[model samples]
Target: MNTLYRKSLPGTKLDYFDTRAAIEDLQPGSYAKLPYTSRVLAEQLVRRCDPETLTDSLKQLIEFKRELDFPWYPARVVCHDILGQTALVDLAGLRDAIAEQGGDPSKVNPVVPTQLIVDHSLAVEAAGFDPDAFEKNRAIEDRRNDDRFHFIEWCKTAFDNVDVIPAGNGIMHQINLEKMSPVIQARDGVAYPDTCVGTDSHTPHVDALGVVAIGVGGLEAETVMLGLPSMMRLPDIIGVKLIGKRQPGITATDIVLAITEFLRNQKVVSAYLEFFGEGAKNLTIGDRATISNMTPEFGASAGMFYIDEQTIDYLKLTGREPEQVALVEQYAKLTGLWADDLENVEYERVLEFDLSTVVRNMAGPSNPHRRLPTSALNERGIAGDDMLAAAKAEEADGLMPDGAVIIAAITSCTNTSNPRNVVAAGLIAKKANELGLGRKPWVKTSFAPGSKVAKLYLEEAGLLSEMEQLGFGIVGYACTTCNGMSGALDPVIQQEIIDRDL
Candidate 1:
């Protein structure tokens, strides 16, 4: 409240609150021992807390105490269509109630910046085998969601500080990673870290860029949207030290699936995990994002990485301005938010994971955390069965056979947001085409990247045609299969499941 420590950024007109100075003033030299999370939280308190209560709140974080509650006001709020629409509907209803009580209905609006993306309504109604699948699926989405679209359109004009990205654009998480977050924000002459709370569980995907992003339910998001602080006790901050490099032929997806299993087994529920060490530093921002995107699957509140060179490279790759990128690097180093500065920081619990131990894996059967090593598929009796003869017989009898794959989609921001994963799928499709291999008759294969930029890169690499030829063409660019919007199965396949109780 005594104007908490302000300093002008070097070579810029912008100024930022010196969170470290304030902390050091309270308890000399304490800033050096604070973890990255604690430092970020401390900045918000210094900027927003009341004068009388500020010391008490900062003490809780500084002493690593979890016995008391504190308040967090995120910098922004993001939403996908499903929950975003519902929250807007609630706001509209609240306005009606206020008007009935003789208050101004027109005065109701969001207090913070809210970005609503229409990504959840589209389903993959048409399979990728159809050349017009993208167009057809988008048409179906508009037809079915006409009323919702109308409401969303109204909210665009009726609200303040709101931005809407229409359907068929991209998934919210991926967009946030590519463009929405600045990593370092300069507003009203002050620079601060970019932090947000989104309506979807995968919102932490952008945390890879060193932003403090977390997913909240609609009600909780509403509270934040109305400018109320999200009260919380200090979370268990777990340090996951990644040692050794990943073995060759291993994708980020493989490592994340393995990490998901490990973290779930360790019972990391409701904790904030900081991934660091040699292996973590070696990973690309795309790889870190893949892991952060699965925070919900691993039962962690946030999967954070320290702001470092990888963060700088990603901002440039995503086409951020040079000045902004320079500002991010300068600000991080000056404030001890950089990874190198966190080397001696201590955590309540530390877990070491050897990355070289990871192998190609898939999570399934029922849970995302149930990792199954691809090498052990035959050993575990999940493959190598003699179903070929039975499948041939069923096909000859004009039935969609047993063990048929109803959907084989490369959907979701989970994998598609990472270029390496998308390129890997494209390469596989290309190799399959060269070998004259094709998808089975009953399998519905589709490639739905989280952003159009993926298409640009794939085409530049000349892998788009091969993917399309293999029945993995682009579909609508929204969350398709992951949101239970996989669309209708073929009539025969549907009947078979119905008749057999599958």
Candidate 2:
């Protein structure tokens, strides 16, 4: 049943084979157990395999055959500022190399459409306790990233098929979810599914919409942009069965923190996770997005929830035009991609989690998946009796001390995408202000939301000022304080940590 296919791509002769049949042929009863992701990859191989050696190649995925190699052509490339800047710097250097070798510098361009947004550069130098922390922090951002931004501007006009969204706009993944990706793309009177590889590990945030977005290293993104296929064997797909509903007052961030811990404990690294069950259907696109945005945190490749009503609803709510939204519904339903149609889908493995068990939580001193439940912080030593007393003593002396929560940053697309989490932080800030509580000076608080629209909603709710009062200001909407570019700590605080090695 192996079939051979040929395609004439620019600068390359492409071939595809019947990977499922190839695998089945190599070993009996193999394809049926393949994960949903593998099934899609097998189809990709079948469509792209060459007539000369198709069968031998497809045996890799189907029969657990890992001998031969296959090339996967993702449809697009996405990037954020940190890695994207470094990537473009590399490309610019590569252009230098090509020019040295007499290759046209102009000819070296991204073959696929590449979207690079300015994120990951801002740091919360001022806490929400400041009346204008956002503006102050933004000023600091401009000072720190002057070099990065200058080069990025050069990249815009110098490269073809590349679009840059400048700094202070929003985080990359949120922008993609909101405006960048059109679920079905139309060009030359033909329509195709939108699939992409991003430079950040959290690119799968858009996977909730069924776009097949994945996070790859900058090297992989560059390869894809150059029209080179990312070669790989299909990944293991794991099904996560969700049950029960989250309790009231629990944010999606809390739920995802718990799920991250559970899935990590289950050892679901590098696997494609497909969440199912009634509970998943009840969760809004926002909630699903929060979980999907944390794919890398759980050590998974892609966290996908099948395209369902929530997907369509979110598309409409985000102001997508009627026709495009209709197209998403039509294409998904017709292509057997609709959620209801996937009931019989099989997976290599399955794990179950209950939503009700999730409590208020925050992740990490370092890692995103290290869930620290608020209730157990004392037991865990993050909020011990001694630590509380130390903080109090520091406050009484009009100084910041141990366990200062140095950065209560409301940043990153991970938590900011969910209105509940964003609003919850604002509510907390508002309550703190009313009660005369304020963020410690050492705590550089910031509210770096991932979208301009987020500001609109927060303003509409009248919570923006409350956040600012606590020194949590609108700090140039970007991935600030996350990704370890926390900017320079306070001079005295830096000396203190250095002195104590704490």
Candidate 3:
């Protein structure tokens, strides 16, 4: 509590708060058994907590006692356009209220670094089949949300410590994973873990890089933005031991869907999960990110992986500076936050999952946690009994029949952030084109990847043209369908559903 230990990085002028020193001081040799989350939380408290109360707070984390509350000051905040805009609007209102109270309105501003990406406002009105779908959809978005865009543009200049990524750039989560987050941040001669709270639940996507990011509501995020600690008790930490390798041709989506079903059945709601073991070690950062992005769907507060080689590789692949990447590795290894160092870390409860048990699958009509194997679609009453007859009837009637897919989109950060998943989709499209198969006329299909880099890889693989030939052309980079922005259905199709009470 009194002058927590600090040490300089070897061969560098920067320094970091020695979390291990603080832990050992509280209880000798206690740092070795602390979980990765606890260690990071402890460092933050030691650096930010009041000197008088710091010892008690460190005790709560060290002893794993949840009876008392502790304060957590996240390093940053991330958001999408919808909630970020609303939060700023509220702040604007607060400024006015301060003026009415004879206070300086201009003094109100965000206390932490805030990044807002304009991703949730666009819709997929122009289907991939259209020749100018991307341009048409973007035009429609601008026409419809001109006033909103104006306000957002104003917010960039009006706000302090806020950065805006304009529309048509990419989804917030993907951008954060690929560009924004520095695994180890150095500021004011001090290095610390990069932790944040975002407006969207999938913010945990960056947890794959070993950064502690959690999704919070606008109000809670506003509290953090105003430089207030998020009071909390230690959560029930559960260790998920992933064993065995996934079968060939299996995607991260399949594995996550299976894990979601298993975890939900195990009553893992509101728990913090740390995934480790051989299976986790084999997974690429992209694969881990796909699983982390689905954290909220599995009803868990966080799904974390310890910092390791994969984390360093991803940082390099994403074009991070060499010095920063080195800092991440050095800091993690020195503080025992690396994956190899966590083998002896203890947890209150543990769950084991086998990756080989997962298969090709998709989630159902409503729940993301419900798993449905592709081979059992007919047996499960999802596929129609007579496909040929239905097609023939629709052809004769000169109209698309009921049960025709109105939207088939690949838009969310969940699968798009993983190159393997995106590449597989491209490969499937190529094979389908070669086999003389095309999308159904009534199906409005689009491929809105979360990052521009995805498009680069797909093109380099010589699969983009194949995908486009099959009516899976690139749409806007912003999120579609997942946020209820799937755009308008054809009037005839809308009428048909209405008439049939579907």
Which model scores highest in lDDT? 1
By TM-score, the better pick of 2 and 3 is 3
* Cα error, candidate 1, residue 193 (Å): 0.8
Give the distance in Å from residue 450's predicted Cα in candidate 1 to where it truly belongs. 0.8
Tens-place lDDT digits, model 2, residues 1-502: 1234322222222222334445566577766565556555665556555646656666666665557678777777999887777777887888899999998888878888889998877776665556666688778888988888899999999999889999878889999999888876654333446778998888999987877789888888888988888987667778999999999998888889999999989998898899989989998888999999989988999998888899899999899998778877775565456787677767668899999998988777678678888998788887787988887886697665754566666787887888888888889889999999976556666677889988888899999888888777776677877766556677987777677565
- Candidate 1: residue pairs that collide: none
lDDT of each candidate versus the true structure: 0.89, 0.78, 0.89
The local distance difference test score of model 1 is: 0.89
Listed in order, each prediction's TM-score against the native is 0.96, 0.86, 0.96
In candidate 3, what are the lDDT values of residues 1-502, reduced to their tens digit?
Answer: 2255777877678888888888898899788888888988988887888888888888988888987888899989998998999999999999999999999988899998889999998899888878799899999989988998898998899889899999988999999999999988898888889999999999999998889899999999999999898998888878999999999999999999999999999888888788999999999999999999989988998899999999999999999999999999998998788998888888888899999989999895579888999988888766755865786797688767666677888878999999999999999999998899988766889989997898899899998888899898988898998887888887877887788765
Segments of candidate 2 deviating more than 4 angstroms: 1-35, 51-67, 89-104, 380-394, 397-401, 492-502
Decoy 3 TM-score against native: 0.96
- Write one digit per residue (lDDT tens) for candidate 1, span 1-502: 2365877887889888888888988898788878778888888888777778888889988889887788898889999999999999999999999999999998899887899999999889898888999999999999999999999999999988789999989999999999899998887788888899999889999989889999999999999999989998788889999999999889999999999999999999989889999999999999999999999999999999999999999999999999999999999998889998898888889999999999999887469999999998778755665666677787899877766777999988989999999999999998999899998877888888898999999999999998999999988899989888888888987877899775
